[model samples]
Each structure stands twice: as structure tokens, then as C-alpha cells.
Target: MRTIHAPRLLLLLGTSLLVRGGQTLRSGDHERGDVPGWVMITLMSATLVAVILFMAEEALTTMFKAAMDKVNNP
Candidate 1:
């Protein structure tokens, strides 16, 4: 739904843009290697947060399913 994937998609797009921009900047500058400083940090931070959120969402779904099973069985 809009309330769920919209925010996540926007966040992902923003992070992707930053990552791409950083790569371009670093590549343009021969002194730097791979991604730039700020881009590397930003990508890592976003990736970490996204992974945590994904895990939490999975946990929440599992918990909800368990609760439903208990209720249905009882």
C-alpha cells in the first residue's frame, strides 16, 4: 500500500541517488578510489538501517502469524 512501500521506496531511491552521485564524484577525481567518503558513509548507513528494518518487519509478521494461529486454535 501507499503507506508502506511508498516511504520505503522513497528512502531507497534517495539512498541510491546519493550512492550513484558519490560514485560519479569519486570516479571523476583520480585521487579517490571507488566511492567517495560521504557517499560511502551514506550508503552504509542506509543499507544498515534498511537491513534492520527488513528484519524487524519479518519478525513482526512471524509474531502476528503465531498470534493468529493461537487464536484460531483456541
Candidate 2:
């Protein structure tokens, strides 16, 4: 059985919220020109990075553990 990691889940949820918030900001009244395009782009880039890091966490952890074990046992 696969276990769900809470921190990873929170990261995903936060990324989703960031994306949704960015969309809402983009869809707001344009006449006021309150939302800048760069802001949305930055939010989306951050979300992407968060997701990538979340996905890579397990692999990175495994690699680190293996390296540590090699050093300790050698």
C-alpha cells in the first residue's frame, strides 16, 4: 500500500491554490490594470518548481540515504 505524505500533499495543495489565485487575479477587471502579467508568470513558475521538487523528494531522499550508508559502512 502506498502511503500519503502530509508535507507533499500540503505542497501540492498550496501549488493548486497559487495557480487558482493567479487565474483569479488574471481574470479580474483589466481597466484598473492592477494585475501585472509578470506576477502571474512568477506564481506559475513557483508552482511548477514546487511540483517538481515534490515529485523529486522521494528519489532525492533515497539517494541521500544510500550515500550516507555508504559513508558510514565504509
Cα error of candidate 1 at position 29, Å: 11
Error of 1 at 24 (Å): 8.4
Per-candidate TM-scores read: 0.40, 0.42
Model 1 worst lDDT run, 10 consecutive residues? 1-10
Task: Report the lDDT tens digits of candidate 1 across residue range 17-65.
Answer: 7777767786666655545566667666777777777779878899999
Candidate that scores best on lDDT:
1
* lDDT tens readout by residue for model 2, 1-74: 99756557656766776686678777765564544465567666766776787889899899999999999999
Quick one: best TM-score, which candidate?
2
Give candidate 1's TM-score. 0.40
Pairing residues by index, what is the TM-score of model 2? 0.42
Every candidate's lDDT: 0.72, 0.71
Query: Which residue runs of candidate 1 sit more than 4 Å off their true CA positions?
Result: 1-35, 58-74
By summed lDDT, the worst window of 10 consecutive residues in model 2 runs over 29-38
